[model samples]
Target: MEKFKITDLDLYYGTFKALIKVNLTIEANQITAFIGPSGCGKSTLLKSLNRMNDLIEGCRIDGNVLLDGEDIYGNIDVNLLRKRVGMVFQKPNPFPMSIYDNVAYGPRTHGIHSKIKLDEIVETSLRNAAIWDELKDRLKKSALGISGGQQQRLCIARALAVQPEVLLMDEPTSALDPISTSKIEDLISELKERYTIIIVTHNMQQAVRISDKTAFFLLGQVIEYDTTENIFSNPRQKETEDYITGRFG
Candidate 1:
C-alpha cells in the first residue's frame, strides 16, 4: 500500500541545496508528518511531492519521486499528477469568489460543468472536510467573509473536490487560533482514512496526536523517521531525543 517512494531526492533553489539524499516511503491512507524548526527542508520536500516547486524560478531536482510506482519526476503530465495529489497551504487561502464556487473550482477546471454533478461534488467535499454543516446555508456567500478556521476548512473542501488520492498540507493550522487548530486537527485525522496525508508541522504535539508516522527534519536532512510513538517517546537519534525533550530544535 505504498503511496509514494522517494529515492535519493535532492532539491535546490538556485545555488542553495534545500534537500539532500531524501529517501522515504509514504503509505496509503495514513497520516505522515514532517516536523522541524524553521528553515528545515520539511516544507521544501512537501512541495516536491506534486512538483509544486516547479513553479519556483531556478528550482532543480534530482532523483526520483514516485507515486504508485510511477516516477512523478519522470515522463508524466504534471497537471494530472497535481490533480491526484492536492495541497493546502499554511494560511487559509480561500478564493475571492463564493464558497460554492471555491469548492467547485477544481471540478470545474477539470470540465465537470454539469450543475447536478457539481452540487453533489460540492456537498460531498464540504462534508468530507467537516464544514458542510457550518457552511451549508451560506454557500453563496463570499469565501473571504468566513473566519480563519472556517476558511481553512473551506480550503480543505476545495482540495477534496478534486478527488485527490493524496493530500499535502503545509502547516495548515499554523495561522489559526487554538480552537480552530483543534478543529483542523480532528479533520486531518479523519482525512487519513481516505487519502494519504503528508503534513509539515512545527507542532510536535499535533504530529503525535494525528500522524501514524513522523519524520524529523533538521537543516535539510531527515534526522529520524519512525512511528509517531517511537519518534516521540523512544526516538533512537540523539537529535530527535533532544528535539522531543525541548532541549533544542
Candidate 2:
C-alpha cells in the first residue's frame, strides 16, 4: 500500500532551490529512511511530507504531494493533515509538563477531555512506543527530567497519542548516546508493524539496521531509492555506491 506519493516536487527557500523534481512512493507499514550528508535536502524532503516547510517564510513548493492517494497540497485541511502525519524533531522536545500531560497533550488538542479516555490513550500510546513500563511510576514527574532516550520515546508516545497514520522522524537520535540510539532503533523496528515511518538520518548504519527501504539524496535530488539490502549491498548508481562506501557524501 502506498502511503505517500510525491510527484515532480520542487521546493525553494527564497532564490535557492532546495529540492528539484523529487518523486518517490512511500509504502505503508514500513520504515523508509532518507540518508545523505548534511545539506543534501534529505531533511528538506521530510519536512515537505507534512508541510512543515509552510512555517518557514519565503518557502515555496511546486508539484504534488499525495497522502493515501489524495493530494496533500490541495484543499486538505493542514491541521488534519498534520494530525494524520505526526512528526518528531531532531531533538527530544517534550512539553514543559509532566510525563502524563506530555502524552496526553495531543489527545487533548484533538478534543479528548474525559479523564478515563485520556488515561487509556496515554497508557496505550506509551506502551506502543515501548516505554510504558519504564515511565508508569513517574507519570506525574516532569518530562524534561527524564533521560534523553526516554524523552525521545516519550515524544514518540506523544505523537502516537494523536493516532497518526504516518510518523516522520528527523534525525531523532542525533543527540542521543549509543545506548539511547539503540533503544530508539529497536523501537522503530517494532513500530513499522503498525504505523508507516519515514526517517532522516546521517547514520548509514542506523538506516541499514532499521529501515526496510533507503533513499539516497544528493544536492537536492534523490540519487537512488531501493530496498535496504540492494541499496547497501549493490547500489546501481556510482553516486550511491560512493556515498555508501564512504568515498564521498
Candidate 3:
C-alpha cells in the first residue's frame, strides 16, 4: 500500500523556492531515507509531509500530498493529520516530566482518561520502541535524568504512544553516540514492521544500513530514488554516482 504520494510539490519561504517539483511515493511499512548535502531541502521535504511548514509565518506550498489516497493538504484537519503522521527531531526532546508522563502525554491529550488504558498504551509503546525493559523501573524519574541514548529511545516511545500510522524522523541519530546511533538504526529496522518511516539523514552509511529505499536529493530536486542497493552500488545517474563515490557532495 502507498502511505504517501507527493506530486509536483513546490514549497516556498517568502519567495525563495525550497522544493522544486518534487515527486515521490512512500510505501507503507517501509523505511525511506532522504540523503543530500546541506541546503538541499531534505528536511524541508520531510516537514512538508505532516504540514510542519505551516508553522512558519510565510511558508506556502503548491502541490498535492496524499496520505492513504486522501489529499491531506486539501480538506483534512491539520491537527488530526499530525496525529496520524508523528514527527521526531534530531535531538531527544522529552518534556520536563516523569518518563511515564512523557510517554502518556499524547494519549492524555487525545482524551484517554482511564488509568488502566493509559498504562497499557505506555507499556506497549515503550516495548515496541525496545526501551521498556531498560526503563521499566524508572518510570517516575525525570526524563531529563536519563542518558542521551535512553532519552532518544524515550522520544521514540513517546511518538509511538500516539499510535501513529506514519513516523517522520529528521536526523534521528545525528545527535547520538556511536552505540546510541546503532541502537536507533536497529530500532528503525524493527519499526518498519508496523509504521511507515521516512528519515532525512546526511550519513550515507546510516542511510544504506537502515533504509529499504533511498532517495538522493540535490539542490532541492530528487536526483535519484530506488532500492538502497541500486542507489549506492549501481546508480543510474552520474550525479548520484559522484555524490556516493565521495567525488562531490
lDDT of 3 by residue, 1-249 (tens): 899999999999999999999999999999999998889999999999999999998899998999999998897889888899999999999999999999999999999979999999989999988899999998999999998889999999999998999999999999899999998999999999999999999899998999999999999999999999999989999999998888884
Per-residue accuracy of model 1 over 14-72 as CA lDDT, tens digit each: 99999999999999999999998788899999999999999999999999999999999
Question: Could you tell me every candidate's TM-score relative to the true structure?
Answer: 0.98, 0.98, 0.98
Task: Give the lDDT of residue 81 in candidate 1.
Answer: 97
Residues 57-116 of candidate 2 have per-residue lDDT tens digits of 999999999998999889889999999999999999999999999999988988999999
Residue 156 error for model 2, in Å? 0.3
After superposition of all CA atoms, the RMSD between model 3 and the true structure is 0.8
Worst 10 residues of 2 by lDDT: 240-249
Q: Supply the global lDDT for candidate 3.
A: 0.93
